[model samples]
Target chain A: MTATTTVLISDRPIDPDRLAADFRKQTAGSGAIAAFVGQTRAEAGAVKALALEHYAGFTEDAIAAIVDEAVSRWPLHAVSIAHRIGRMAPGDPIVFVAAAADHRRAAFEAVDFLMDYLKSEAPFWKQEVSDAGSRWIEPTDRDRQDIRRWRSAPHSGEQ
Target chain B: MTTRILFFGQLRETAGRAETAVDLPPSVATRSALIDWLAKDDPALHAALNQDSVRLCIDKKVVLAEATFSAPNEIAFLPPFSGG
Candidate 1:
């Protein structure tokens, strides 16, 4: 069967538990499932909210491309990505990615790979609103380094 | 022809607006030329856009500053991404 890929960008809150359950149902026959959820950090009351902005169609396309790359690189059954845009308060879910595969290794690696690319390459801009002030956030040097690891090592199933 | 220019993230803050339409002069044909033209009147915008980390996209596709086309419909200035 052809691998299924789902990508969604929501302005509303994302329920990570619901997303995981739905992915598990969709990829029922897959032997392993791996998932990751990112949440807005409270920063000890210093940060009040996070505002995320995306280039309507462009952001989704960028994420879909990353999903396609992940599917190609791994022996996967399905992949699902959900990201939240607009203003979000602390403790809110920011993003979720789940991958299903026949083995544990493929499932684990795909989620990791998807996140690294999303952090640095996706076209979403982020701003943090804090008690002191608001400031735009960009990918750190560590983020760049995280993504570089994939480029330096060739995956087994790479085209 | 009027080309729509979009600024995102810190560039949006620096530009003071999300988007603007500019009618290109004859000399402002290339992407680099367009940046120079836009930066001519605004020092803050020039400084923000000239940063090495900023990227240019033509019609939603990232392109080099030297890339040239006539009367493109849209051009966007994107700062580095910070998504999760």
Candidate 2:
């Protein structure tokens, strides 16, 4: 198989359709395609506004590693991820991840896996400013609980 | 020797700078040692580094809290990432 492309971007205001097109162009098989777009919400609870920050060089490298891990762990033809940085207003686009694979299962699983890893593994930080004042948002135990699910495989009864 | 230590998000805001040079004690050979040394110098970083919720990376690679560090390296302390 030829070498596929992996797009990892960190910028202000992410474009979901552009991310989808990137994945589509990278895959030749065109059997199945899956995409996930995560946008900023009006209410994240306790968060009046979120300011995301990352190390200039280190952020990109950390994200690239996550993308590489996704490519290795799954049979994906193409994968792309984009995230926004700086002071972001509510309801703005935050992140995008799209993958194309030979089957829907692979595509879906790959996207899910990438999202999980990105949430817990990537090196980005957000500070929530609100009526309570700006505080560095820390990942709650629930976030870890969600991450733990990926470590174990649930039987699908494929027999 | 000095190493470029980076801080992100709240840590940067608390420290009031994105990156700064921290003096390394002579026997500080690992990443873990560097954190210990830094905490001794900067109270804000000391508290942030000691928090279980925080993480560290060296030259863009996540390393264990006790990982070794070399001279002229890039180090960063950041809260957990939730990009997706």
Q: Mind giving the per-residue lDDT tens digits that candidate 2 earns over A1-159?
A: 332656555556777887677677667666888888876665646556777776677767777776676677667777777777777777777788787777788778777877777776666787777887877766667777766776765321111
Docking class of 1: high
Model 2 earns a TM-score of 0.84
Complex DockQ per candidate: 0.86, 0.68
Worst 10 residues of 2 chain A by lDDT: A150-159
- Report residue A64 deviation for candidate 2 (angstroms): 2.6
Compose the digit string of candidate 1's lDDT tens values, residues A82-114: 999999999999999999999889999899999
User: Chain A alone, TM-score for each of the models?
Assistant: 0.96, 0.84
Q: With candidate 2 superimposed using the best TM-score fit, by how many Å does residue B31's alpha carbon deviate from the native?
A: 5.3
| Global lDDT of each candidate | 0.90, 0.71
Segments of candidate 1 deviating more than 4 angstroms: A156-159
Q: Say which docking band candidate 2 falls in.
A: medium
lDDT, residue A54, candidate 1? 93
C-alpha RMSD between model 2 and the true structure: 3.0
- Judging by lDDT against the true structure, name the best candidate: 1
